[model samples]
Target chain A: MSEYTPLSEVGEFGLIRLINEKIELRNSSTIKGIGDDAAVLEPGEKQIVVSSDMLLEGVHFDLTFCPLKHLGYKAVAVNVSDIAAMNAKPTQITVNIALGARYTVEAVEELYEGIRLACENYKVDLVGGDTTSSHGGLVLSVTAIGEVAKGESVLRSGAKVNDLICVTGDLGAAYMGLQILEREKQAFMANPDMQPELEGKQYIVGRQLRPEARMDVVYDLKERGIKPTAMIDISDGLASELFHICKQSGVGATVYKDNLPADEQMLQTALDFNIDPLTCIMNGGEDYELLFTVPLSDHEKLKNHPDISIIGVITEESEGINLATKHGNSYPLKAQGWSHF
Target chain B: MSEYTPLSEVGEFGLIRLINEKIELRNSSTIKGIGDDAAVLEPGEKQIVVSSDMLLEGVHFDLTFCPLKHLGYKAVAVNVSDIAAMNAKPTQITVNIALGARYTVEAVEELYEGIRLACENYKVDLVGGDTTSSHGGLVLSVTAIGEVAKGESVLRSGAKVNDLICVTGDLGAAYMGLQILEREKQAFMANPDMQPELEGKQYIVGRQLRPEARMDVVYDLKERGIKPTAMIDISDGLASELFHICKQSGVGATVYKDNLPADEQMLQTALDFNIDPLTCIMNGGEDYELLFTVPLSDHEKLKNHPDISIIGVITEESEGINLATKHGNSYPLKAQGWSHF
Candidate 1:
């Protein structure tokens, strides 16, 4: 195989065909997919929801540890997570990628492999997008289209006083995973012969490298005939998302410190690094968990679910957003979500 | 004003609010805009058409010659042009932008100013997006959502033998404008006191810096009771787009070289640079014009339209795509569209 086939050799049309052949559309709403100026969808009676996110290299990830395939999967997963947060089922996604000339056909194929895998896993169609050259590094921007019954889609502003605050899966695992990866990268750079010290760190590392969107939770809740009054994906930490809900819903929340779910491996890694687990859970970003609220009457349906934890309850605006400690003390919660700049 | 206020000072939420406040939704279909995980739209009986495009600094635009305001407008206009290519009316757009730390709050506002202006001009709503910091340089990604009655949206594969090919507006002015801009930049760099030779060049320069999507032609066609058999936007070039239509429709085209439309200014500039005007009209990029085909029965309806030109006639696949010159010589057409990679 050639060490590197310059992208110019493939040309724009060749590269487009190369990527287009690999996509398999799974959504029935997709009337036409790719190979066109725009993707067409038949949404029918359902209202359509759309959201877009852009990720830049060096700002969002370090290439030293990030694999192109994993990066592609993460980009799609993160965007789908946003759709799930709206209590809407993602029907299609358009992924636009701009890459520097240093990449080869093989490199792009790897990235699309991950993207296609995620599309299949999420059961969403690969609809339309643009492939272009970048000045340098890789820039990925994804727009997800979803559908929900009119008035059924949830929003951050729907929470009210007495609403029960709940969260899906565990928090801070992805954050701890990043720290481990960073340390391993430094050691590997110092000694080219050293293998990564990743033993017993598989869970956390996987969380960081391939965090899954909580679509299962959305499905599970719908099956149980429950609707979250408010919902948001935990891309920017729990406390920060809580602030969004509180500020928008004109309410307050009190989450217990002990109730915050932390994986055993995540906690252990946090201790080893002398980083407080609570801080990681509160401030570290990219967990992709679901943070939502339900009315008090619906608590019985969710309390028994092992994947979910009832962490707190909503309160009047005067009560303020606070974190209640195991020691019975409450303090105002501050948001320190990822601020790349 | 504070000199170069670091973006870190305002945080992501603040930046979001700064841009969001300026956007006012004009589309009644937009049930919910920004501040939610996704924007909701009610398209009723119309089919949803979506398209996304990403623009990277240095690759898609040179900041030295392109102003931020025009760049933002161009980014959104280009994506809308894709939707128009499908014969759809764009309703909403989501814009995602990544900027380097060198960008000030003022710079971001200026970019959004252009975006808002384009949205207003196109009657599109600014529905949802993510704003984040980049590693360096500027990156803009826009997703345009449009709606058309079921079976009304045009496709590249609809053209049949004997269909009359039509093109809107003029071509190649944007490419010449870029050439003039590059020349002026080089001259200005070499001699600080030298003035730009851009007088009487507004038409070409406007085409390059702020090309508008041809939605006017779509409306006119609807009024004239004509539906294009096949349609595509002249983004890459007229020849490149015609190639797409031919490949998808399983037909060939015969375009008269003399019938291809070119602005007087564009023709003069091509002569000044010693560039073949025919090549410029056929292969130059960024025109953002619409190319479509109408049945012979509807040809008389469009023949009287001042802005529309009957450029060619479709032929059987066996004949091959060819161009006929004024002197009666014919040759196979080649699509040398922009291949930046």
Candidate 2:
């Protein structure tokens, strides 16, 4: 509707003000936000948890297909996911972004639009941040601060023998989504006139571009009075997360292939890409789902949940982490996670 | 000496473990650091302060003369300076870095060496961070967490008429040091055989390469029982920071040019470059000095401090910010701060 304004016209201070203008503090513990040298908070009776994540341009995302708004929302969601993994409710986040001269003020505003939306969705306060220039592409770094009740926070090292290993929602959808996007990108590069064949692929495509953090499941578990024995977010694939839980807890796991949830579109897309859907479920990253464990005694409380899938069970340390096929063969799981470096 | 190790040889996980090995938690509030999904802290009775900063290669630093270790140390110091600007004690920091493929494991370790040194010196714990790959140059983003007694944090919007404006340490040296470095770089390019004439220029050079945050001033003010009514760090020079305080506080001020502090090396280097030292003091950036305002009543207590200098007095809102010359003439001050864009 209007002409775009260059970032140089708005300057750093103006950009910061624009980013903070619509940010309403959702967390009461946030005493001050985004004006002074730092954000002030008073964590009255809760223990605080802090986590940070950095996303580079080419290293983390490709701007050719990823919308700036989705990129912004994904950045915040991923950091909030880390806080959720700690069984803590995220309260505040400080976001820092570096932009190249090629970016306009409108482009930055588009990115912040997604950030604001995610902040509202998560009910986290937008706190202090620094906006600086970058010589390369866009860089977003977010530090999330959350709080959990003392001694109630679930850790990766707390799983014990007979603990039920659970995962939230479906796995491999985002991985398939990435595959679809990559294939479309290749097709588009081969010829600029080719239309993307994305019909009926919305379920998997959305998972890749706009993955939601499993905070809803965290709330669900609390409401049902089911405390997980151990927890971790499924960012680095299901198999790698299983290794984290097993290694930290000094235990082993046995996950059944049939129990791993997969979206129908994800399976179809995996076949289209000539890849095994099982491999996608185990090794595909960027799911942002919760993979946690519960004590056997609390199994009755969690067994009937619609979205929660009891994928596996914790075993003795000597048993080793393995995946049992539907046909009765068992194989040790390997964590071939993403190596960004 | 041992040969340098390639970063690829160590991979991301090994590099993380290498960096986390020597970190010791100094704050009792840090329940957990650098292992799980997030760092855990329990700030029992204090309010928390959070700040973040991002430094991009070529945009914020030059590696030709800037040592990686100093870069690492300066990155932490600059973020900690923001916490100190709020009159809060820094407790923990999460450092996120993106290194290119050219970097070796030893290079990352060198950078961490400075970070470790700063963490030890500042008594802040290295909590958690994300280290990945960047397609361009290095990127370092640090988020510092600090704490203060409730209602004791200083802000930039609290200055009143007649508040004594003060600054810690000498100014203009950092700007001059940058000038020296740039000059030497040009000379070296012209004559590869010539040695850098850095014998007496070490003070000014060090000021530019490794500026220290003024946490000592915060401690000094507390010990002297004088709290600044308003405060800001001099990252973008004196006049710009003065404008920020005045605009935010809804007040005006007058500063005397003669009262500005200049290091001996800085003054000489400025003249050698044929640039006026007064201009460097007023408009030069990246000094990392603390500029603050104190109530007139506490002037008697703070006036005798060794590093603290009372440079000016705040005036009524109608009186506009002005700079009084060494002569009887006064002129309106313009804040031509650094424009990174």
My TM-score estimates for the predictions, one after another, are 0.99, 0.98
Error of 2 at B276 (Å): 1.7
- B194-252: candidate 2 lDDT, tens digit per residue: 78888899998999889888898899889989889999999999999999999999999
Tell me the tens digit of each residue's lDDT in model 2 across A9-43: 88887887888787899988999899888889999
Q: Candidate 2 — which pairs collide?
A: none
DockQ of each: 0.85, 0.86
Query: Per-candidate interface C-alpha RMSD?
Result: 1.0, 0.8
Candidate 2: regions farther than 4 A off: none
Give the docking tier of candidate 2: high
Model 1 spans > 4 angstroms off: A1-4, B1-4
Candidate 2 chain A, run of 10 with poorest lDDT: A1-10
* Residue pairs with clashing backbones, model 1: none
